[model samples]
Target: MFNRFWSRFFSSESSDESTTSTKNSKPDDKNSGSETEMTETSNEIDFQLMPTGLKKLLNKVDLSHPPGLAGDICEDLATLEYRALPNLRPAAAMMILSSVARQIENPPYKLNLYVISTALTASGKEAHQNYLKQALMDLGLDSKLHDTPRSDKTIMFDLLYSEGCSIYVLDEGHVLFRTALSSRASTFEKNMADLLLQLKTAKQYRLSGNLKREVQEQLIARLEKADKKKSNTAFQPEDKEKLKNLLELTNECIYDPFVNLISYSVPQNVAFLFSKKEIETGLLGRIIFVRGPSKRAPLRGHDKVVRPSKDISERLKAISTENLPTESLAARTTLHTIKEYLECDENRNHGMYGAIFARGYEQIRVVATLLALESKEIDQSMVIYAFKQFLNSLHECETHLSTQSKTSIEESQKLVELKVREYSERHGSGSFGVIRNNIFKCSAPIRKLENNQKDFLSNTLQKFADLGVLIKVGNNQYLHKSCISAKKLNTAKKQST
Candidate 1:
């Protein structure tokens, strides 16, 4: 019955958009007797003028009431905007919604989304991050927030080892992931990407580190302590149990990690770096990209400083700790909605599109759950609003990428190669160490780095070789042809003098 209602409603909406196309194309009244025959012929030969199913579905949505949590976050962002901060109101709000969804237990689908928000530099990415940090702090979730994107090792060792879930708010994560997938991406970046994929899809991920040495050391220390205690008292069963549990920590090999990654970056630098293959990986599809509204100039003044109110802070604190509805009505609604989304997009026919539809279905359900709040059932209106928001995100990402040209990318690469070659000629010899130092000194020319500069330089130089900027002469040794040209020019000038 629900499907029937939506189908009828959408059909009517599509009909409305398709109205004049058919009427305007119809033949004149003089041929009225043969109108039926002409119409049939046109129907057979003419293209269908109906609005796309997805567009009509999105158009029917009422976005007035976003999920309570998301709405409140947006309001907080507005407060920041009033204070003259670079405002990413929409992006901040969606990220908060994604964070809330991460904490949900036994969700019908994975509620965690790899969210990215893109804005131009000085457009408030930093200020927006600060606002989000303050909001999370108000909710007593400040401990869960991380400034940098963690490697798979750190993620496992720090949060997942003890806590089941964590929310990492990383700045420039678009750079991290994009660089990781680029031609010169480092192993650490690749590992981080791989680990994220594993956690997203699998219920449990295998640990890669060795535990045997640590376990042996712990056992030895415990035995020595027990022997020392032997002189004072008898060995207790509890002591044996304590040792057993300690041993178990090393023996434990699998972990269930629920991590929500909210990343902020510049659109041009990050989003454009993604290739078709990356999108096909299903990882890119999992991301909902929110492009901030552009501001021609930065806002300034003491009058613009709007602090978060006590009421907003208290509300956020209350919601973070409140018990959500136990009923599965919202989850069921989400499942049904996902089914409809997939079915409706059947004619779209592309792997990336299908992946996106699946990911959006999950994201919408997450947003719906955040909106559900204390309500036992998810509202149909809220789910539709969330779905519409996802569509908007998809549109933004597609439009941004579509606007970029291959020539521009090639030109950018050429600039990077020239800068690298120039740096090598000025300061580096053929040795890796000297070349690496040169790369660091001129690192300002590099767009992105993972964790630190050293690894980035190494990976970048390797990429330069791959791009034919340098030829590898020996292990960890590279020679740039430009360096030779510079040397010859210097010798010629000396001879002329």
Candidate 2:
């Protein structure tokens, strides 16, 4: 059922290439102008390689291709290869690998991939360590992947001294983004930023190997002391200057060390998970969104479900390697293409696309992430699609959940009315309020006593009240007007005549 929904949701759309570019470029590029140039380089390379692999994958998968590439165009395609296949881990991994590859191919300015997400932990750092080892092994790269579980300071020191370690993958990237924003000088983010600044100003410092350590330690201590003093009171002008200096230093030292980071989750999940400030600072943009169907709902009772000739794990590994992109350009292109397809359907109010389309706030983060992955020149059309897909998913969840809630509410209302009527018949009209209050003690509507009792009560007393058969006294008190007739002597005298 979900497959059918997703198909109709994604398949029925046509997207124009020109339209895609316009919609994906809203985020402010705060990075220096040089960063923009690097992104352009990345885009040029990606556009060249994307079509062949994309066409092949589209043909292999049953899903509909983005509009304009009809079935006929895709049919003849054989094996399409994503460039970063061997190194591509998940969507996030691809983003990092692609960025690094782009930098290697076109250098002079350093590139950084910031992997920002909600949380990070060192408890299972070994798993990532092993994964990196396996990744290096698979690539046949003659390098040992070290599992460095050191303090941020030590790591920075190691990075400074380590020669030929051009790619520094900061696993659990969200931590760094958080630190960068932290006000505390002693925080890892501040320290890391400081280290980067030192690296950039290497020529300025001109210290020998051992002297570099002393200078770094001295600088870190000075920053820490300054941060502590600021914590006690408002940041004095000097302190503020120092903080800004530290930031600038960090930025300079990093020299654009290719910082590749990625996170695997739904776009909304990432948005809700990260702070607004982080998203604004392009931290969110660096993330690459990789989406796949939940494994919980596997296809069942199909002939294809039978044991495959190859090992399932091997098949999955092969598929992941085959479909994944090795370079940033390819990854960004794939993301852009998929985003376009999702948005096209969403604009037309097709399937879950509407849910994503309607949620504008989350859409921003999703689009920003895509833009970051695409080297920060996302088309406006892409942003619209991100929103549309987000809204579409939200709409589906809301529709299903709301329908159940409505049904339950209706049932409860019926039950409440039935109980109110039964209580009224057993007790009496004057006691309607008391009965209702007792029956629905916690219910605000019943407790408020605003509605006419006649709707829920069928007894003659209630019916009479509805027909003006009762007189309302002070304090919501009611008395049957017919009782007054017997007491009136004029009425009695008239009857006798």
Candidate 3:
């Protein structure tokens, strides 16, 4: 019965791609600017020359073409009018991986594939995001996914106590990065980054901080929902006791948060947000950056609603989600295979490749995810698939970052400060939030800032206040400092001369 079901699932996925690929296909770009550039860049990487054991494994698996879960998801997402890097499929697979994560215990680290996708505006970044979310929903795992987290403390609490496996998708990941780099980042920002770093490896986390209003509201909502489903809900009396215990233990901590994250950001000025210090410290190293398509496929208007093939729904229903034992010899063998690649000097020297190379075992974790999904032993093929996905993601990152517009961070800062001062002089004093918002809304050389840009502005304004460029008169409010305006001083000098 299991074999029969899986056969149907595979057939459905195959048929779905064979039928719909052309309709939602990427535009053939022989002359487009970004497309030409990307093509030239991709040509530089020799896929046939094996650089890592993972690549060797991948070549062995696909004597002809890439296959398995990642391939199927990529096909399905493409059929849905989304153009993205190959990493989208693996990143989307995280939701499925989360289910399997629940069954594994006491691993060295939790299964967390931290992904950060960067793309140009209107270049299917949003479409890629929608595709991943839809894939989860199709697998009947919508409830496992959450929006951009409100705070770090909230994530810590949810991972500890939330039912089932969880994956939080942050749309404006750059905002979080900016906050981390902020000169005066709120205590909330620092704590959240620290907590995420901890949760990445440690099974348990100590949740401090007095329970905030958000936590209280979430608990009340959970209780209300439990009452409504009293007939079938799994909220037993012990569960209630557990919730009470969890509330009290907020001061102490909780254990085994098997959580993962998927984040998306625009590439504009993102590199500037990270300092050399942050990069070397492994904060940036933890993230896997996937660059979206260099050239967006032209958007086509369609009356028909495009969707993933039925194979996805069938597999989710038919496949057993039992996580295999992590201690098994096969798992150990998989680790050794990945270790060989970790030591490769060729893989180590790639540009800004520290983030990708830092977590060498990430390939093993991803392969484990594949093994769990297939209920099969770790093999060269699975490792290959895992490495190929990372290779594509890494290639995309290098290509995109290399070609990204390089704006001087200092120049950008001066532009923002000038805009803020102008706004303050015209409108009198305003709150930091107000000043930040106004600067972000600029249309000239400043243009519109992304969410992260606005966040950086907020941080910059606070630093300005500290330096006497602005004075903080009230909470979240600031006024320009009594200093001669640069423009005025220039005019005065001209008249004196």
Candidate 4:
């Protein structure tokens, strides 16, 4: 039966079969040329490995198992490690399930794989249904299939608890799973919020078996620690204001599911459209935000022209599966590290990660996760370069990067002037205010101030006072030249004598 399924699958060839065959036949003719081309291409493709230092740091983590049932569970868990493979979704799923099943002690628990499709089909006549059936059979789990559709919750739960079923697979499941889980008569916004929340929670908690419960407990503990840290700090008024704004932005992104807002919109508009209350609550912080190319954007030359390349796709599939466990652990570690980093006021001033989060939250997270995974396996410089490239890609989609650069330059200049004036006033013999005003005349560039006359005047006056040329004796009243250098006074006295 397996042989029949495999042969049927491979025999049904697409139009590219002839091209593939021709390429295989001519392999020797261009072997040397292609090999050189491939080497250059391989060098060009960016593949950052983990740093040795990071690897040594990670090695300190104790991955060893404990005794008894705990040990047994850990041992069982080890067999279920299936990394995601490229361009081989069905095969990857099959491998993951098979590994999971092998770890179990009792064979009585049935595993049913439920594959969901986004397309609507009225009957079994749909080609997709046949395709799914074939895929299941190819995986050698055709007998485990439940004939009933998953749209019905009662049927789903029953199948889940049923003694005959063990593993369930859902293919192309976004719409179907979302619709089934949604509350009847709920607003689309509410449904989306519910869906995202459920997915996040499930991703954190759900596993092949009892491990789900253990993972949930660990998550709860982590949350508790985070909550305690938040409670310990008292925010200043400015900090409080910023936090309030950030929270409101987060809420809008997370809860508001208006199709127009969620599907395709500018980040600023998306942030502004959210309800003010939602932003204050910080619900958006929970989301894995992503900023990718818009569907409407024109394809680049590289993307627009594509030739059949099975070898490329196959190689990607193989590469994708190489570091699954490492990637997963790295993702968790990176998230926690980022959270800590963002919480610090000093680190916030650094602004690289913050800028990425503001523009491309999801992409930054993915890049950070990948970097964490590779931190141990690659050179430090290579890892840093890869991270910079990831950040650059995110920055390219948004205008924030240019703005940040300008702001940094302006702030640095202001700091330099302020520091020089402060030092001169403290020790120099000249009138501090006069020196400050002269310095301002020499160095202070004109600013295009709008609706801030009072602030502008205040800053100007402060600069003079810092230089010791002027002193404010009363409200809005200034005393100039309170004291002059002793050299000038001595010369006047000597001339009079």
Ranking by TM-score: 3, 1, 2, 4
* Tens-digit per-residue lDDT, 123-193, candidate 4: 11122223334433544445445432333222322222332232333333233333433456334323334
Query: How far off is residue 289 in model 3, in Å?
Result: 1.3
Model 2 regions lying over 4 Å from their true place: 1-132, 137-155, 164-186, 190-215, 218-256, 263-273, 295-497
Clashes found in each candidate (C-alpha, N, C closer than 3 A): 3, 39, 1, 37
In order, candidate lDDTs are 0.54, 0.35, 0.55, 0.30
Model 4 weakest lDDT span, ten residues long: 29-38
* Cα misplacement distance, residue 350 of candidate 4 (Å): 13
Residue-level lDDT for 480 in candidate 1 = 70
Q: Which portions of model 1 miss their true places by more than 4 Å?
A: 1-57, 60-67, 82-87, 101-103, 209-250, 253-256, 297-300, 303-308, 320-338, 344-352, 374-376, 404-497
Per-residue lDDT of candidate 1, residues 1-497 (tens digit): 22233334322332433332221121110101110011121112111222355445456553322545555555555445522222245456655555655555555666666777766677546667777677666666666765565454455544432355667788877666765565676665566677777777566654545424533465668767776786555667676566656455555554446777788877676755444456667776677665553432335333544445677666554554244444356546545744564546441334335556556666776666666653445666566667766755655444444444334445655655676677666655466667666555665655443232346556656777665567654465666756657665455335434
lDDT of 2 at 153: 52
Of candidates 3 and 1, the better by TM-score: 3
Question: Once model 3 is optimally superposed onto the true structure by TM-score, how far is the C-alpha of residue 124 displaced, in angstroms?
Answer: 3.0
Best by lDDT: 3
- At residue 34, candidate 2 shows an lDDT of 12
Top TM-score model: 3
